[model samples]
Target: MSTPTGFMEYKRQLPVDRDPIERVKDWEEFHKLLSEDELRTQGARCMDCGTPYCHTGIDMTGGTSGCPVHNLIPEWNNLVYRGLWREALERLHKTNNFPEFTGRICPAPCEGSCTVGLIDQPVTIKSIEQAIVDKGFEEGWIVPTPPEKRTGKRVAVVGSGPAGLAAAAQLNKAGHSVTVFERSDRIGGLLMYGIPSMKLDKKIVQRRVDLLAAEGVEFVTNTEIGKDIPAKQLVDEYDAVVLCGGATKPREFNIEGSNLKGVHYAMDFLTGTIKSLLDSNLEDGNYISAKDKHVIVIGGGDTGSDCVATSLRHGCRSVTQFGTHQKAPLTRDPINNPWPQFPNVYTLDYAQEEAKAIFGEDPREFSIMTTKFVGDDEGNLKELHTVQIQRKVDENGRKSYEPIPGTERVFKADMALIAIGFDGPEQTLAQQLGLETDRRSNVKAKYGQYRTNVDKVFAAGDMRRGQSLVVWAINEGREAAREVDKYLMGSTVLV
Candidate 1:
C-alpha cells in the first residue's frame, strides 16, 4: 500500500507532451518523462484497495476493464512509492514480457478500473510502469537470462508480433529451442509497421528484439509460412507450432470507386512510410507522399488518428476524418457508462491534438459515412461523397444507420485512406494448414487451452481472438506457452 493520505494530499498528473507544432515536424515521441519525485507522488496516489480490480484482468461493458496480463499493479505501485525502483521493475516483468511496448501503445484499461478512480482521477499506472522499465534500461538492469539447460524440444512460432514474441520468450525460458518467423523484412510485425514511429519509437522496439536474439530466440525475417515455406513443414519439423500471425485482413469498403489510384488501405500507407523512413530517412521516395494533397481519412479509430498525424507530418494541405458513430461525451456518463468499466468518452489523441494545433479545429466529424470515392479522369481520387447518418433500431434490437436526407455532400480530396478495422486473420496460412475457423473467420482455438483442432498446433493473439490489444496478445501468448510446454514435457512450470 502507498501512503494512506496520498490520494487526498496530491492530485493526478501525467508527463507533459512536447509542443504540438514542434513534435509534428519530426517523428519523435511526444511525452516527456516525469521527474522521480513526481513519479513517486503519482505512485503514492495508489490506494491499493482490498479488491484491487485494477489487476483483475476481466471484461466489463463490452470492453476490457483491467490489465489483461494481470500485472501486480498495487505491489509495484507501492514499491515505486517506497523508492524501490529495481524491485518495481522485477514485479512488472513478472507478468508482462514487454512493459515498454504496452506503456506506449496500450490504451491502459488498468487505469480505467483503478480503485482510486471511483471518485477522483485514476492513478498514473501506465506512466509509472514505463518509468520503471526505462530506469531499468538506463541503469543496465535488463539483460538476457538464457535457460540453464536445453530441454531439447523445438518450437516454431509463426509471426513476430507481440503474442509470438511473448510465446517465444517463455518457451525459450523453459529451455525449448524457439524459432520465430516474420513475413516482413524486419521483425516486430505491427510494432515495426502498423504503429507510427512517433507513437512508439522503432529504436525501442529494435532494442527489445536485439535482447531477445541474445537470449537464444531465432528470428527468420522475410519468410512467409504458407508461401516461402510450406505450413506442413513447420508442424513436421518442430515439436510444436504456435500461430500468432495477427488479424490483418482489412474490412472492405465495397463502395463505388474504391480502387482509385490515390486510395489505399491504411496499413499499406503506414507500413510504407515507416519502412522508407527507417531505410533511408524518407529520402528513398518509396512511400505514398501526401505533400500538398487534400487528405481524407475514413474511420475514427487509432489507425485513422495515425493517418491524420502521418499526413500532417508529410505536409498534407488539409485533412478530415469521418466517423460512423457519434462522438462520446466529454466526460463519463454516470447513468450510461458507470465506473470500473472503460468510459466511452471523447478524448484528444496525439494526432487529433496535432491536427487541432495546426488546422485550428479538430479534424474529426462524427455521425458521418463515406458513400463513395469520386475519381478524376486519370483514375486518381479527386473527392469523397459522404452523408450524415442517424441510428435506427428495429424491434428485434438490431441497429442500422440511415443517411439523413439533404445531408449529402462532396469534399475535395487528393488522397483517401481507409482505416476501417480488420475482419480477422489472413486465411491463406490457416487454410493451407487445414485449421478450422470461427464465423468471424478467426482461427478456431479455445481461449485457455489455446490448442487448435490439429494435433501439436496451437494459436493465440489476433489470429485466434481477432483484432485485440497488445496486452491481450501478450496474455494469450504467455498462457499458450504454458499449455504447449505441458503438452510437450508432460508437466510445466511456466505461467
Candidate 2:
C-alpha cells in the first residue's frame, strides 16, 4: 500500500497490440511492451487490499476466482511501482516459475478478482508481470543458478508441459537430480505445439528450457514412459517418479463423414502447423495447409480461435468458427455472476480481431451445432450442415442443447477442424503402472497429495486433474513436488 490513492489516481492502461491485419502475415508474438513509466502507473493502480483476492486462488461458481499459482501480486506490484525491477522479478519467481508463459497466454483470472476492478478496470497485473520478467532477462539478471549441491537422489518427471516443467524446476531447486521425459521430439508439450507461435513464441519456451537444462535438469525427448520404455523402469531407477503427462486426448465428434480426408483434429492441425513452421518455415509442406481453402473450425474455445488464426495465416479463402453456446453478455451480471468470479463478458480476442479485420465481421457463429460433413466423390470435404440450437436447463439441473425448427444451414468448407477440448490423459501409462483412475479417466490422486495407487509414484497436472488452465497445472506441479520431497527426504522445504 505504498500509494494509498494510486487506484483512484491512475487509469487502467494496456499496450496496443500489433495490427491484426499486419500480424496475421507471420507467425510471431503480437504483444508489445508498455513504457516503463506507463507500466509503473499501471502497477500503482493495485489497491493492495487487506484480503487481496487477486492471489487467493479460489474456485467459485465452477470458475477460477484468482491466480491458480497464488502469486505474490501486491508485493510485486508495489515493487514494480517503485521501479525495483529485479526485486519484482524475484518476488514473481517466488510463486510462479514461469511468469513469461502465464503473463502472455493466461486469461488472467487474477485481474477478475482485483479489488480495483470493483470500481474501475483492474491493475495491469499480467502486463506488469511480463514486463518485470522481460526486463530481468534483458538486464541479464535471470540466468542458470543451479542448486549448490546435489542430494544424489534421482527423480523422473514424465511429460514436459508447464506442469512437468514446473515440477522439474522445483525438484532440481531442492537439490535432487531430475530428469524430464517428453514423448514429443521437443521439450514443451502444449506450449511448443498445441499453442500457435503467434500467441506464444516457441523461442520464449526454449529460452526457459535452456535455463532449466543448464540448472542440471536432464531432459529426455523422443521417449515415452509406457511405450518406448516400461513405466516400471523409472520406478526402479529413480528414487521417486512424478507423472505430469497432460490430458492430451482431444474430444472428437463421431458424426457422419468425420473420417473424410479434409477432417482433422484441432491439435493435429495446430501441432503440424507449428512443427512445420519451426522446422522449415512452412517450406517442407509437411503440414495441412489451409491455403486458398474454405476453413470451418468447430468449437469456440481458445484452441478453436487458434485454428481460425492459423487458417487465416495460411491464406484461407474464408474462415468461420461455430459455438453451441450463445455469445457472452457485454457486461457481467452482478446477481448470477458476482464480483471476484470470472466475468462472463464478451471481448474480441486476438484471433477474432484478426478475422474481423479481413472478413469485415466477426468469424464466430454462436448457438450453432454441426450436424454432418458433406464430401465430394473424391472424399474431400466440400460443405457442412449445421442447425441453430438453444440451450435448455432441466429442473434437475442438467443442461442440454436442442435444435431449433427450420434453422438448418449449409456452408462450404474445404477443411473441417474439431477443437471441442480434451477428455483426460491417455490411458496407456496409467494402465501400465496399474494406477487407479477417477470417473473422469484422470489418475486417481488427491489435489494436494499427488501420490497414486502405485508406490513411489505421483501424478499431477492434467494427468491427475483432467484438462485445465496452465496456471493450475503449474500449481499442481509445485504442490506435487513438495509432496514428493516429503515422501523422499522425510521433510520438505518447498513452498
Cα RMSDs of all predictions? 1.0, 0.9
Quote the lDDT for 315 in model 2: 99
lDDT per residue for candidate 2 within 346-397, as digits (tens), equals 8889999999999999999999999999999999999999999999999998
lDDT of 2: 0.94
Which ranges of candidate 1 are over 4 A from the true structure?
Answer: none
Give the per-residue lDDT of model 1 (tens digit) for 459-485: 999999999899999999999999999
lDDT value, residue 220 of candidate 1 = 100
As for candidate 2, its clashing pairs are none
Deviating ranges (above 4 Å) for candidate 2: none
Task: Name the lDDT value of residue 123 in candidate 2.
Answer: 87
